[model samples]
Target: MQGNFWPDHIRRLIEQIGMEHPIIQAPMAGGPSTAELVASVSNSGALGFLGVGYLTPEQIDLEIRKVKELTNRPFGVNLFVPEISEAAKPSDKVLNCLQEFSNELGIDPPQMPGPPKYSFEDQLSVIIDHKVPVFSFTFGIPDKALIRDLIERDVFVIGTATCVEEGVLLEEAGCSAIVAQGSEAGGHRGTFGSTEGTPMIGGLALVPQLVDKVEIPVIASGGIMDGRGIAASVALGASTVQMGTAFLCCEEAGVPGPWLDSLLSSKDISTVLTRAFSGKYARGIKNRFIDEMSLLEDEIPNYPLQNSLTRSLRNASKDKGDSDFMSLWAGQGAAMSRKLTAQELVDALVSETYQVLKSIGTNL
Candidate 1:
């Protein structure tokens, strides 16, 4: 599409966010997300977000250094806000069950571990120290102190929200923009508070509704794989778009071979959302591991506990190139994804979007 197809607000938002293209590469924690991928996307005129959810402050700094070394293009970093509760802890029963799975996979299960804890404060400190151009987060909001600090550093903060209420909260907390993550998104849902039945909002419905609800620019995410999807999002009033699955198929995404192969093979019906991998709900291709976890859901521990317990098995599975135990995080748009370099993907998306817009103009 002609650049003017985008409104002044969208153009201003894109320029303010430091992206030549309105695409923002969604951060995929655990693996997949790498400095190479982030740098490539950013260099290709799109914004790349490095996933720092599971990394410590020091690690975050290291990755930021690596991204800077690879390219001087502005990129974003994503953090996971910590949420704690009694029920989220591991119970003896759950531990024993996890051990059983560990034995089956021939890997040692984790011993009794401490409660879930991560230095969100320290991570924020690193973000401030690095002075990244853009910051994005999911799971929940940070305190006012953290928010103020990020702003003081002149960091453009973006927060992910699954529902409109959460979007409003992000804006109230002084976010530069909001990522309207639909249920069709891969990886963990950014549902704040009680993880109720998040209205399974697809991009078509979610983007426009969220745009109408919030004045801040909305970056549409979930099940978006091509220029048609991007054009659709802009038509719905989104200033930009964020994508994870599309990048998963990129050369720079460091996922194991099985993961990429699965993405290539998956169809529309091959995916499901399960709390199997991490206790927290996420969407992925239905695999034997998830199927087994569904059968033993009641016995599984919460989040980090279960996540820790299965770490060895998951690692072993990846090493062996087995798809069964791999956490194949992918969205409904997986079927449309193509294996390409990150730069190529961004260029193709821009070209395709321009074509669609031109077609529409011709019709008019």
Candidate 2:
């Protein structure tokens, strides 16, 4: 119930982020992670995150200011590390598949997206200019120089890792902490390292491994939806836990109606890993888009390209209140999701964590 009860690493992280709880609301980019959601979670004594992966530098500045307005508590900003080269292009099959989806959604045919309006450096400038208390990144480790600058400015940097190798790479790259994102996590996979295939290690196995290999704290993520999951993460040596799907249906979350409804009704087997939505493996509830795209998994272009090609179609689906084409991102624990206000949810999680830990201590 108190910071003193937690391990030194956990306590240190909480203090470093100015949060009362060692919990972080996973930044769900594109939507779901709204300014209101971020602020509300931070106000609830846990760290919240603004997912600025898809936002321009200007938009990122505005969102950070908005969160500052809503909560004095420290929060974090998450970015997607740019990995795609300028010469990378989508294959014709990828474009034609998107075109078919566009026709079905009555949207214009897909086109190859131009380079980003701003570079990752531009985005980092906004984060540094604002002196954001916490910054996290996924997809890959950023350049050491940029990370050093952030650390020099006292910005607590967290990097996401799907495997121990990536975790070590992040530690060497100067990350203050690492988020051990399990395969069960929703949204985009944080895997950027070379692998035989996508790393499918679950949190129960991944957390302790990363903790053993890395000296810095490891934040367990993926399929962690409740206090029980949080306790399990701690037991496995994670300093804290990062949860996303658990908060997907929260009142302050910016989830679309159809996507929200899908999550509310999701079952244990409801989710599947697919690259259809973003060309990066992400777990989400099965829907028509994922089902149809499963056949073209090999043909789908890599991220940013595939993500851009389907942006209009996904938007059209959302606007039409259709879950078929919209990316219904949710973790495996979605069946346990509860619809509550951000404050109420955090309170519940803290209370439950206390109770669970107490019971475990007594039993041990």
Candidate 3:
């Protein structure tokens, strides 16, 4: 029965990506998606992806080892492909804007460090050496040679696309699959071309468009909460469904208590996409910081620069369990989120998908 509507296509995708189900857990960085969470998702017959951003290669290695021990099934690792901020030395403008917001939160903003310094090469090497089964990336595409290495090693390479152009680029770069990230998606927007003002497209529209435009499989992400959403994605021609907020409510998510509470209480309008947190624009719960900071965008530094400046404030908020200051990343379907175990959540999603398909005569 599982193989009927889902069919050999999904099973083949699972075999290609080394998973049992078509569900891929969106890799959310900043301590939300953990190895335990990934392993749980993997062990439960779904693809689990660990967000390996903002960490050193050694730190990533440690997490890989931990997940490997916890689950014998195949798991995935998500990385933030490095991108250069368009602003040349926009630190002064960013610092001034950050100071005002820091004052509101009653915290001191850190001084401008020179430029962003993270070893993408080293991280790539670690992923290759460890031979992670599925490697998904966001922000931007890596060089062609790096893509070749992953392909040569038979790693399933997934790239993010905010627009059809980005999807085309990923196809050209040899990505095995594409995650069509809609405007409602949490975390950073994967708008690659423009450094500023990328047009926002909803998943309902973006998924089918990308599917028609690209040859590779398209995974629907953003605002996907339950089985109906999963079936809708499949009906729209998506091969898989990737969700973040759905899992954030799971026991394995390990987010702060206050953050979880906020997500639970949130309505559809509760989330917003703001560059206030990381200067790269991520969709999260609209809080005091995002509202006030959005008023002063001109002063915000570009991505890693603004990202570094607010690290302390975000950390403090996380430690103190203050949802107001923390970047509570979540999709618009947050209200539909249920507090369940990872395995339970996966089961629910699968069940819901079957029912939706049955209702639509796709599962017959």
Candidate 4:
């Protein structure tokens, strides 16, 4: 029953975005989401997302230019909502541990990174100036004025939510879509409101609930690996699905050779929610860094600070082919994943979804 309705709405939104499929390639902010990868995904009839959270406004312009060069299709840009946090300095003991870990990885003494590459205002301006087709935000909701400005410019706005209240807030704030990010998602937890009270809800539970509540279209994310997953989301009343981990193994991803190899080879990779990598709780493959830093959970500095502090070590680990020290982000569905081109993955997902629905109809 839920599957039959909302066609006109999703269809209009899809027409507005110029996407052939309702599938969205999750905007992985780190290294994996490259301009080439995003372009390829967009060219494949799906919405490609560029994670510009770490890039400067200049870099964002360059990447956008690159994607534009590669594909004439519409793609989306994701930004981290700017927040002001006070003195999130790490404790001496944790600092010593980080230093030792850096030494072990043969990394240079971590230079305290300058503040995040771009401010929200600067980045937002870049998007507006470029006349970006779609804009999405995480970490927290943007002010109503920003949303209004984007909407007034005819740019589709999407907000990520980890709970029902956040979804309601996004709808109220005028988002064209709400991405219900489940706990099984990799990279970062997009819990907007209270981080301390964030619910680690599973995708199936979270998607349907958000769908039931929101007036706008709800997108599902987290732990979705293949065709069956997409079908499941559609059945759960999601207008679309956003997948990050599934695309991690795609040929176009900018994942390090060793990290890609680790993702491909692992038959059963377990993920843990640790703030060790970025100071914000995110799910990633369990590794030595996470294990050794377990005792520092309470003291791990907040994001941007902790994220900047570990950049050198993460880069060094990638260079040295040490997966143990790398922030190997993967969702819970990593076990049943495959390596393919972006187009091939999307085609397979579409086919698999059809087959799953056919079988269900026959059985029922």
Which lDDT tens digits does candidate 3 get at residues 12-36? 6877776667899989887878899
Question: Candidate 2's residue-wise lDDT over 174-265, tens digit each?
Answer: 99999999988988789988465679899889999999999999999999888899989988989889999999999999998999899989
TM-score, per-candidate, Cα-based: 0.94, 0.97, 0.94, 0.94
Task: Give per-candidate clash totals.
Answer: 1, 0, 1, 0
Superposed Cα deviation of residue 172, candidate 2 (Å): 0.6
Per residue, candidate 1 scores C-alpha lDDT tens digits across 1-364 of 4545567878999888778889999988887889999999999999988998888777888999999999898998898888774555566766676677677778888665655455888887787788788988998999867787788778988998888878888889988899999988988888884346645777788788889988889999999999998888888899999999999989999889999999999999888988888777889999988987786777676665677667777888898889988889999999998999999999999999878867777331
* Model 3 ranges off by over 4 Å: 86-97, 100-108, 114-118, 194-196
What local distance difference test score does each model get?
0.85, 0.90, 0.85, 0.86
Candidate 2 off by > 4 Å: 86-91, 362-364
Candidate 2 accuracy as lDDT: 0.90
> Least lDDT summed over 10 consecutive residues: which range in candidate 1?
193-202
lDDT of 4 by residue, 1-364 (tens): 1223335656666677888777899999877889888999999888999999988899989988999999999999999997678866678877898899888877676666665555799988998998889899999998999899899999999999999888999999999999999998988998868545767999999999998898888999999988789878888888889999999989899988777776776655578899998888898888889998888888888887888888888888888877877899988888776889998988888777767877888332
Error of 2 at 106 (Å): 1.7
What shift in Å separates residue 306 of candidate 3 from its native position after superposition?
A: 0.8
Clashing pairs in 2: none
